[model samples]
Target: MSGDAPISTPWRPSKKDARYTGPRACVKCHAEESATQHLTAMGRALEPVATSEILRAHPRLTFRSGPYAHEIVRRGDQSLYTVTDGVNTISEPILYTFGQGKAGQTYIFRHDGSFYESRLSFYKDIQGLDVTIGYPREIPPSLEVAAGRRISMDEARNCFSCHGTGAAYGNQLQLDRLVPGVTCEACHGPGAEHVAAMEAKQFKDKRIFNPGKMSADDLSQEFCGSCHRSAEQVISNKLLRGLITVRFQPYRMFTSRAHDPADMRLTCTACHNPHENPSADEAFYDPKCFACHRSFASLKSPAVAKTEEKEGRTDKACPVAQSLCVSCHMPKVEFPGSHFKFTDHRIRIAKAGEQFPN
Candidate 1:
């Protein structure tokens, strides 16, 4: 498989991806910020790979994704990332280093079919050692493309607007129209309107459709619920598999104890870096009950640790439930991505229906 050196033309919508917009449009307004994004993990996932210099540096690189189904290949310096065809519903390959493996390089291949931007491969071992992949909150591959809800007017269909940067939705049956992922306009909307206003000095239109505004409440809060909440599939389509609509579902994060319409109000940007992933590696989000929270002297989920012990070490300052504010409040529970492991987003007392110690 080969990836292109650089896409020369702008993404054109296939009938299947008529509702989508590409990322390039957003960069027109956010050019400066996206530069640093190319370095972070979130940006790295979507980083374009098309050079022989990076391709030939490693002995072996990943060409597929996932642990069981992942594949690896060695590249020659003469080779560059290029697509086999320009118009087919197929993808090219690029090397990515998820982490190191005992034997050598462990990686995943980046791919696109045209209508949407998503990763493939089952992600097995990096180098030769087993590695962690996919954040606790990310959707899986089998269901990512599975057909359930129709793409024309479903929330699931609309989700790709932000999930993908420059992707477009073409004809209902045409997956090839969903091209590219994670472009700037996905969040900021097409600069065609914004840029035009800016050039005309229409300062009032600065936030024509910003998420953080639009109501007395922070409109951005709705952004997190777009993916965090769990809702039923309108149909059985896998491509529409992510949480797109924000209607309340019991299992969804919004209904949990951590979220109270009266007490707690959090937007997507409140606890997360929107330009990034689910923020799993943020030092507190291991599927485990303890990580950074093991130090909270107070019972706040994200509370820092402070010790008042007779004789103990500083580590004790962050006691297990005592240190973990989330543990104390947002009890850990299991979900699809983590069956054996539990999640802590609800952020309330660990013992359900029990009185909180704090």
Candidate 2:
């Protein structure tokens, strides 16, 4: 869909055309993939919820920081937030939710032609509200504005660009016509030409951008890094490097010793399919790791692969356990306020009570 009209014209990617042909256009050709992708975090990353639904799920959503109290209440069709310190108060209607809400959901409101994230966010782990991810737990007493964090225009566009498909048209946010969540066009690029060619029964493939076909390093930087911070992005934003940003898989993966730009198996797609929810079973990832780590020079005893040899010495398996490579290597660490633990993607031997590798 383009604006208010159903796109029926033959697609032409000109300066005046609607380049993005929404996920609905891909349903007929990619029904199974489309159906499954909707369940992934990328698929439902952003959603516009009715105030009634928000109130029904979290009847008394609230959080307290210092002398102030932040509460979200539904009044009729609109959802409004009231922040108070027992003296002054500010109320604003929330317009959008920033996450799929599996881990957490931060509310956003529009005012003065821009968006602002709420002070408090709802985390599923606690099933209550807490300070939003990067914000400080306690607000300064001198600052009176309690409506929440106001996002800059660039920040607003960047947030929506990653969270929702077709939310931008060349850096200009089309917030009113956002497609809510990540969709086919988000990864595959605009589907207008692809759909047009397919519908016309053309035998040749009308090229649509596919990250899967790109080189491992290019894929990491362009596709995955479009949202997840890449090595270059992390390096550039040196001040932002810390435990909190380690959840960024691309940055961590590209920084790892295992990352080989020339090796196709080293990419994120080797272990993850964006269309499906990643399996939590750590053992399932062993095969992927072993593909490069395991020694296969044991024809006499094919069932038992030999240990890897290094510096004229053969290493032995851990006496305590065998499988689940991720158990010790990609240890789970919790972000300060997100209330959920994500596996450290740096892929290293982490020791107890020591600072983790960046």
Candidate 3:
């Protein structure tokens, strides 16, 4: 499960060879999975400004920091992002809304033929706007800077490649041919070949990449980590030393002492159903913990003993408690200034007043 051979997938959006057939093509066979997955956060990750429910619900949202003022207002079918310094002002029609607004939504717009990420983002907890995460906190020198942070060509390509399907092609972002949100083709690779194979009953070689076939370690560190930030990505990017890194689940989980690379049960997909939103019910995860932590004697079954013997390892049940194990060990930590709390993936006894592990 740890050092298995790499499983290749043709899901790279940057390459023109990947032909995406959209999620609609998948509904003919996988009706249920297609239906539920489309309702997940990843399904609605990116949407056009005109169809944003958050903006439609709240016609106007505003925030002020230092001498700058930011506002996002809905007029007709368009949402306008405006920023001002009293003397000078800049405004633009938001082109896209990133995120489904479960936690928050950020806007992206074009000004002077350049892409810019909105300076202010809508936080659901606050029910208004605030400075977008990772932006400078100080006052901007000009109205253009106050309006939004201009993104580079590479940044734009990267953002769209992850948020939307078929948005990237050969080192560039092809926004004109973009498909909003992470559709079925996004993870499963191009479905045109798979669909045709299935239609013709050619089961031998379906020609679709199944990420489920990947090993536990490869799935966590390579497949999902390609977007979610693997340990290698965090370390290389010099982001290994902050509360902000808590948002990167793969990196935090990789750093955990409890992380056994050979255990498939410890992988992300083992606990989280990637096709749906993560379950908030703590009880849902107890079985995942019990798969390893239950005492062999307590099991009173031969099957349990056989499994533990085969795995070459056994873990004792928690001496302290049995239920809601994550409440203490995997506590949720609030990201500074983001107005959101993310569950820390580092599985350990979280002692109060203790410094965050390096």
Please tell me which predicted candidate would have the highest TM-score against the true structure: 3
Model 2 — which ten-residue stretch has the worst lDDT?
Answer: 1-10
Q: Over 4 Å off in model 2, which ranges?
A: 1-16, 51-55, 142-145, 295-321
- Show where candidate 1 strays beyond 4 Å: 1-35, 38-71, 76-163, 170-180, 214-222, 227-252, 262-264, 276-324, 327-343, 351-358
Q: What is the lDDT of residue 2 in candidate 2?
A: 6
Compared with the true structure, the alpha-carbon lDDT of candidate 3 equals: 0.79
Give one digit per residue, the lDDT tens place, for model 1 in 1-358: 1111111112222333234434454566677766555444334332223332233444443332332232233444332222212232233354333211211222233333222222322222222322232333233344333111122223323433323344343312222433334444444444465666776889985733465543312233333333233323222224432322112222334445334343223333455555654454433533233322233534453323344222222222234433334445544433232112334444443565653221
Q: TM-scores of all models?
A: 0.46, 0.86, 0.91
The digit string of per-residue lDDT tens for model 3 on 207-299 reads 987888888888898888877877887877764568878878999999998887767988999888888889999988888887777643445
Clashes of 2: 0
In model 3, what is the error at residue 91, expressed in angstroms? 1.1
lDDT of 2 by residue, 1-358 (tens): 0011111212111223457777777888788887889768788787766722445576567777778878887666667777888887777787777774445788888755667777677777777787777766667453334567667776776677677776665546677657777877767767777787888888478657667778888887656776776677667765666786666788888877677887777688888988888998988897777666643333234345433433222333333345788899888988777788888888777799988676
Candidate that would win on lDDT: 3
- Candidate 2 local Cα displacement, residue 211, angstroms: 1.1
Number of backbone collisions per candidate: 63, 0, 0
Which model, 2 or 3, shows the larger lDDT?
3
- Our tally of clashes for model 1 stands at 63
